[model samples]
Target: DIEMSTSTRGGLLKGLGRKLAGESLFMTTYVCKSATGMITFTPEAPGRILAFDLEAGQSLICQKDAFMAAQEGVSLEMHFRKRLGAGLFGGEGFILQKITGPGLVFMEIAGDVREYDLAEGEVMRVDPGHIALYEPTVDYDIAAVKGLKNVLFAGEGLFLATLKGPGKVWLQSMPLNNLAAAIRRYIPSKG
Candidate 1:
């Protein structure tokens, strides 16, 4: 047997912050009345689900709506981009989801996952939508793609998200936005 109820872990302000960070305001909690019990979670979209066990004070910054589930000790908060360029053209906008942990956290990646570890001062340029997660040590910003021909005919868009790192980063090959746009093309228009 099990009992369940709504949980607002961090109170009103945190709940409000979660809402701004693209998560639900209320979280559900389950209590097991029997000697043993279990629970399961699934991704909201067609994607891969990955889990991380973080030590106290460790944190990960993730793309909006990436959070799936986490243990009770994990904290979710809104992360703001301090750079105007990042805020305006970074693709993820000004606000992102930041999860801090002393426990396990699960995230949903829109498609296949790729992991990279960057040595100090190394940089990687990526399409903004493909960004999945990164350590706080990463310096994130946006830069315009160089060369007129590349910008006009490369089909890679104008701006690229630049990540300078001394830590690990994760990217997803199929972004949800790209998938939605692809599907939208086939939907019949309402006359």
Candidate 2:
């Protein structure tokens, strides 16, 4: 007896949190009464799907809208950066999604994906939008790109994201915001 129902998964507060994190308020759940059952999931955009099996007490912080799905026992919560600089210029804004585990999770990364394992105290600076996911052990911050010419004309924007670590990081070659900006010029305007 398989049953399906849709509602705000963690009640109203959690649903509201999900909404603030740029996801739909209600979630659909499927129950399997028999011994085994199968289900499929897909991303909303053309991208690669990555699966993670998380241990109890583990957590992964991801870009907003990157979450695809997760199994039971996983919790999706809001993550906020304490620094005003990160909130103002981090590309992802302040509200990111934090998925905690004891179950499997799926994330969608736009375009090609690259992985990096940073040793302790190692740092990698990146265009903020390219950041897809990272382990909680990594320190995330934003640095103002030095030099007036580079900041104004280099086209990398005012601030670059700084990931200092001893943890893994995943970056996407194409972020949806970049893709939209690229084609925006070709779009017809009312004017």
lDDT of each structure?
0.92, 0.91
Candidate 1 local lDDT, 37-86, one digit each (tens): 98888887788999999999999999889999888899999999999988
Best by TM-score: 1
On lDDT, the candidate that comes out on top is 1
Write the residue-wise lDDT of candidate 2 on 144-169 in tens digits: 99999998899998899999999999
What does the lDDT read for residue 57 in candidate 1?
95
What's the lDDT for residue 21 in model 1? 90
lDDT of 2: 0.91
Candidate 1 regions with alpha-carbon error over 4 angstroms: none
TM-scores of all models?
A: 0.95, 0.93
In candidate 2, position 100 carries an lDDT of: 95
TM-score of 2: 0.93
